[model samples]
Target: MIKVLLNGCSGKMGEVVVNASKNFPNIEIVAGIDKFPTEKYNFKVFKNTSDVDIYYDVLIDFSRPEALVDLLNFSVKNNKPIILCSTGYSDEDLKLIKEKSNIIPIFKSANMSLGINLINSLLKKIVPNLYENYDIEIIEKHHNQKVDSPSGTAILLADTIKNSLPIESKYVFGRDGFSKREKNEIGIHAVRGGSIVGEHDIIFAGSGEIIELSHTALSREVFAVGALKAAEYMADMFYPRIYNMEDLLGI
Candidate 1:
């Protein structure tokens, strides 16, 4: 059995992962770290990672950005592989994750859905060719409780497209008044309401036609399942590197 350390085990995604892991016979969550610890679903929870005594083969974190830095540090100190499913990390935090991957395997992704990764790969291949003719726009929606705007997944999509372009593309988060899109600008719009799980749509518009790619997540369990698969995959690999769900899916 693969022993797992679950970080942010009290949050929404954390709870989903905890419940899902219980049904899998090959994996076990040995310990959990969460800020708000209340007995839920008969799982033992601690307020910090230091309280856990068992050696974990992999650490899965679904916490906030504030909690992620300490979690990454602890994972590095313990020399344990980490599957970071959390979103809202700043550029500096992302740089740190890349730096830490030299010593320990770090699998990170903004969107854990396999389909979204596939979409990202497709975008990378298509964006360069369509750069001149197509005007790009990304619109994302999440639950009202999400603190960050535009969502990390949206940023990832925009960045991938931007990297593919010959010239650097400017990102316009929102527009007001009589503002018109620049030729080299990628527009990103964010919407928050209700309990929506997640949604992302990318549009490429031209003179007479429009091409669109979209992904809608009906449940958060898809992310949980993907993260578990990543943990299992990481346990079997020896190389230390940063990876995304696309690498896991071999797209």
Candidate 2:
């Protein structure tokens, strides 16, 4: 069995993961870490990773970016692999994660949905062919409670396209009173309302045709399932490195 230490145990995604992991009998959530501890959970939940005393084979994080430092330190000290599902990490945080990956295996992804990662792989193949004539724009929607604008998945898609393009491309997030859309720019727009699970649309406009690649997450379970899969993948990994969806999916 793969024993998992779940972070953000009281959050929405954490709840979803808790519910979903029941189907995988081989995986067990031994303990959790959350700022707001509750008595309802079957497993013990602590306020922080430092307080955790349970034995876990891997760590799964779906919390905020602020938890990165402590998470990395604990994982490194314990020599345990971690699957980070949190978004909105700053460049410095990413650098720290990457540096620490030299000591312990770290799996990170902006979007944990397998469909989103597959869409990313599809974007890489098609963006290069259409980059010259197509004008690309990305639209993303999430729950109103989401703190970050232009969801990390949106940025991931934009980066996928940007990296595949022949020339340099700049990102313009939600333009207001813009003179005109630049030729070498990728426009990203965000919508937040109600309880949207998640939605991402990549629009490619050309003179005669428009091609759109879209993915709608009906529920958070998809991410929970993917994160568990990542947790399983990380459990057996002894190598110290930063891994992503590409590594998980073997893309």
Candidate 3:
């Protein structure tokens, strides 16, 4: 079995992973690191990653942005590969992760769902052909308790579409004042409501016609399963580099 250390052990996603991982025959969660450590699972939980004394082949994180620095430090010092699934990282945090990749392999994604990653790949192909003639806009909705605005996944989708353009395209988060939509601006909007798992919609509006690409995440298991797959893939990666769901999916 591929022994794994799950971070954010007490969080909602962590609980989901704990329950979902049982079906995977080759993976076992040996320990967990959480700010609020509890005897909540069969394995031990530590408030700090450094305090963990058990053995684990890989690390999987679905925690907050605040835990990132310590996690990176511990992982690199111990030479453990990690799949980072947390969102809401600042620019400097991302820079630090990229730099650390030279010493320890890291698999990171804003969203872990395979459907979203597949949509990311499709946007690369879809953006180039229609961006010039179409005005792009994205609408994303999530549970009310989610901390970040215009979620990391929304940014990922927007960036994927923006990067596909030959020229620099501006990202407009939301519209308040009545202003004409610029040709080069891509609008991103976020909605927070009750009990919604995840929803993303991208519209390409032209003079006469409109096209929309959308995806809805109905359950948390999809992400848990994908993260487990990523964990297995990253378990044996000795090379120091960053990997993503696209790499695992070969898209």
lDDT per residue as tens, model 3, 123-228: 9997999987899999999999999999999999999998899988899989989889888999999999999999999999999999999999999888899999
Error of 1 at 78 (Å): 1.5
TM-score of each: 0.95, 0.98, 0.98
**lDDT tens readout by residue for model 2, 206-249:** 99999999999999999999999999889989999999999989
Clashing pairs in 3: none
The superposed Cα distance between candidate 2 and the true structure at residue 228, in angstroms, equals: 0.4
Superposed model 2: Cα runs more than 4 Å off? none
How accurate locally, in lDDT, is each candidate?
0.88, 0.94, 0.93
Between prediction 1 and prediction 2, which has the larger lDDT?
Answer: 2
lDDT of 1: 0.88
Candidate order (TM-score): 2, 3, 1
Clashing residue pairs in candidate 1 are none
Candidate 3 local lDDT, residue 79? 94
